[model samples]
Target: MEEKSGDSLATVLVAGAANLTIALAKLVAGLIGGSAAMLSEAAHSAADTVTELLLLVSVRRSGKPPDERHPFGYGKAGFFWAMMAAVATLVGGAGFSVTHGVHEISHGEELGNLTPSYVVLAVSFVIEGVSLSKALSQLRAAAGRHRIRPLRLVRITSDTALKAVLFEDAAALVGLVIAAIGLLGSQWSGSALWDGAASVAIGLLLLVVALILIQSNLSLLIGQAAPRQVETGIRAVLLAQPEVEEVVELLTMMIGPGSIMVAAKIDFCDEAGAAGVEIACDEVDRRLRDRFPGVNLVFLDPTPTRRS
Candidate 1:
């Protein structure tokens, strides 16, 4: 947990720094270049800065100890903030870009100062790449331990803040490249329409990525179940104990990244009466705790089979 928290904090910090730099640079470049694409990029970076800050707060809050008001802890706070960030990306970033793109297309104005705009885009791309590398390093370490792909880890892991930052940085890099291409094309062809079109494309790309983040965070907030393989392995471990005859039913839900709570019904063949069954259940719980350190909560109910 400590390692994950540190990684999450580092990722948010890097993202925030990158967005701050990119937003300011793009805003100046856009005004000087009179390019809609540059202005749209400025808005995108500004929104991302706000999102990264919110994610930082969410990560800190989620790490708090369980309180009387929150029995399951504040883990879901990260998910809620992540969802809001996605919405903000759609509204504040993509919305502005689309609107500006439409206005540029209708006005058909010529853009100026292409050289400084390209320079700013290049610098922004480099900064975004650095942020992306930090996020990927953390994600790769976690994913390797779980023996899963990075994309799959992002989809299922409790590290929604890291996931969000990584995605946004990646999208920002791609958007910068697209904007540069459009700028160059318009400069060579003497048509500002291509630049406006690029802004629209960037907006659409952000909208798609935002929707994905929103859906993923929603799933986490609604209580997604743990992977089937992990649950099966846990059941097998419980049944391996001598006091546990068989696991009748098992249900597992992820409460946080790398943390789960399990509720199970088990049958015991080592004892006959209710008192004996209670003892067996206690033993099973201890064994499970010893075997699966990631399981913070375990509720085992003993049920006697007809044969037993």
Candidate 2:
């Protein structure tokens, strides 16, 4: 848990720093170019920057030790802040972009020189790509550690901050292309409506990303199950142990990003005593935590089998 937590924090910090620079560059280009689409892009970048900051807060808060007020510790903090970041993206990025685009379209403002916008968009694309690469690299390392494929790992892991950075950077790259196209089209056709249309499209794109993130956060907050494969692996290990006879029930829940709580009911050998059971349970707990990075907490109940 310590190693994984540290890596996650590092990834989010890099993303946040990258977005900060991207946002400032876009803001300058938007003002100089006076294009609705470019201005919307600026707002979008700013929203992403804020999203990274919120993720950082979530990571920090969630790392706190368990307390009486919150018996399960501060794990859920990640989901709460992740949900807030999604909402911020919707309002700060999509809302302003669409509304401002509509206003500009209705009022028809002439777009000034687009050279600065073009230069900045190109630079932003490169920077965003770099950040996306960093996030992807970390995710890939995580997948490798778990011996799972990339897509499947992403589906099962509770790394909301990493997911946010990957998807947001992808969206940012796409939005930049759309903005550039809008500017070029408007310049060639001598109509500012193209720029407004592009801004609206960028807003719609942000809406889609925000909705996905919101749904993911809601599911995690509500408590999701671990992967089927993880459950199967655990059951196999328990059954293979010499002290165990049967695994009556196995349950698992994702209590936080990269954190799972596991419970099991087992029937041990007829001759095994209390001392033997304790040793077996401790061994199993250590094995599970070592083999599966997500299995941070495990509880075992050894009960006698009822005769028919």
Candidate 3:
């Protein structure tokens, strides 16, 4: 657990530093070049930097030991922080860029100084890609154990920190591309409207990405289900117990990333006496814990089956 926490903190620090540097550079370039696209990129980077910081804080706080006020530990605090980060990205970054883009379009100001804008954007893209690669590597390592593709794993994995970082970095890269295209269109055609249009496109892209992240985090917050395969595997393990004649009901929900709480009712064979049935249920619970390390809480209710 300590090793994992240290690794996560290191990842967030590296990514956050990259974002801060890129944001500063982009903001300067945007001001000097008067390119709407550059300004949008600046906004996006700034939001990313802030969100990364929030993620770092969340990770640290969530690692705290359980206290009287919060007996479950601070793990869920990470989810709430991640959700706020997504909202910040959408509102502070996307909202600002879209508003500025509209203003530029309305005022019809010609873009100026293309050279600086291009330089900053190219550098930003490289830096953002590096940061994204780190997050992706972590994600792949974590997801590989589950034997699922990275994209699908993001949907089901309990690691909100990884998900938030991946989405932000990916969006930043795409936003950079959009900004570049818009800047080039304005430069080639000598119409400033193209620059503003590009900013709008980048904003929209970020908005969509942020919304998806927000929805995913929210679902996890509300307690989502463990993957179907995991639940099935747990059921199989339980049924293998001789005392467990059959499983009548099984309920599993994710209490945190990669952690689940299970509630099940099992029926014993008709011939089994009360004492034997109790022993069977206990065996089933023990086996389930052995099979599914992620099952934090397991409750087994024994029921008698009708004689066939």
Assess each prediction's global lDDT (C-alpha) against the native: 0.83, 0.86, 0.80
Per-model TM against the reference: 0.92, 0.93, 0.90
> Tens digits of per-residue lDDT for model 2 on 187-289?
9998989999999999999999999999988898988777788889888888878899988889988787778889999999877788989989999998888
Candidate 2, poorest ten consecutive residues by summed lDDT: 1-10
Quality of model 2 by C-alpha lDDT: 0.86
| RMSD vs true structure, all candidates | 2.2, 2.0, 2.7
Under the 3 Å rule for N, CA and C atoms, how many clashes does model 3 have? 1
TM-score order of candidates, best first?
A: 2, 1, 3
Q: Which residues of candidate 3, in runs, are more than 4 Å off?
A: 1-7, 270-286, 305-308
Worst lDDT run of 10 residues, candidate 3, spans 1-10
Using lDDT as the measure, name the better of candidate 1 and candidate 3.
1
lDDT of 1 by residue, 180-243 (tens): 9878878888888888888888899889889998998888789877767678778888887777
